[model samples]
Target: MLSYSEQEILAANVNPATGLATDYLNLFNEAIMLFEMGLDMPDMAEELADWHPRGYIEHFEKSGFELKDVVIAAYEHAPADIRGEFDAACERALTMFDTSIRVLMTANLEDPAAHADLSDRLRDMKGLVVEMDSHIHGRSPAQKSLQSEVDALF
Candidate 1:
């Protein structure tokens, strides 16, 4: 369904075969950074709480990513089945992240057990990002892990 020329999409940093981009993953990175940092710095909790979920196109539109338009168009044109799987995976990651934040907000980071548990949850979130990264790179990602990871983490 994507009509963009190979040159154009690649120029925009999108993987032509997958019609997917990596810039979107950077958004997840920000959340991970904040939460991971929050584990040690109690003050970061306020900043981490502001992190919220956004879908692919919405993420690009709101972000200052240089190739926002191209990324949005490519995502819109991505194959239905792949996109659906990707979106479901993203939704799972999003839910897990949001839930982790809510739990972190109430948890006392100073406590050893709570701190360790949230760290484990954050690691799973990072794993989901790796899965997303693999998908964008046109690698044969084990998509099943996306769901199972969410099940274990969420």
Candidate 2:
């Protein structure tokens, strides 16, 4: 059985050869912690309103996880529609992660085939990041233009 730290260290390494950046690892750690908390809270609906990573929180909540402070922070930071999207994505990603973890746990990496399967399973997580990036970057162009205008005004 993998210790929690071992699991975290393994999970944090998105790309070993390229070496995952600290920011990405931090984001992953934050995402995992918030995911677990979101799974245990009682007033999930209310809490979700303020989650910082609102998207991921909402996603997990929909996947049957409980909501906690992360939900509240999300609502505090995101607009209504974006919050909804975040929640949905969080739910989807959490579901995928849960299944992926189970699959990884069942595999015996001593077998080369099992190791390859584990690798494939991890690569699948990149989709979650991709989905998040799409949402996070979708508004960048407009935000940049607005930022430039504000900078000029100042």
Candidate 3:
């Protein structure tokens, strides 16, 4: 588990600009709070549903979620002449992917049979979007189809 001081340092490193830093800082802090709450209790969905989106806790709960947040900040700072737009889109996809992972993780740990279905849905979405990335630059029909599906998901 990450300490508050560590999280703060990470947030500072990830968000340097004074203008828009607060939003990014909030995002990371919220994720960390939700993750810690989830870790403390197994019924994460219930614990976080009132606080935020159901899957957000799980999505931001992982070790790599902070890194992904940094990636988003970099995309936000990228030059217009560079691949900023594409990078931002990719970052969005990754955030969605992480959210899906958290939802699936919670669903798997859920006792109710209904949650299993939710888990399956999240897992399917994650798998589809991740698989589509490999073919993003390709012109094959399969690649085109996957990209379409991934875009729809994002």
- Model 2 is weakest, by summed lDDT over 10 consecutive residues, at 13-22
* Candidate 2 local lDDT, 1-154, one digit each (tens): 2222433433532222221212322344444434333333323323333333323334334433232233333334445565456446556766666565554445454677866665564455444555443344343223444444232221
Pairs of residues clashing in candidate 1: none
Off by over 4 Å in 3: 1-22, 50-78, 81-90, 101-105, 110-154
Scored by Cα lDDT, where does model 1 land? Answer: 0.79
- Model 3's alpha-carbon lDDT is 0.41
Lowest lDDT 10-mer window, candidate 1? 145-154
Best by lDDT: 1
Which candidate number would show the highest TM-score if scored against the true structure? 1
> For each candidate, what is the lDDT?
0.79, 0.41, 0.41
Q: What is the lDDT of residue 5 in candidate 1?
A: 78
- Using lDDT as the measure, name the better of candidate 1 and candidate 3: 1
Clashes of 2: 26
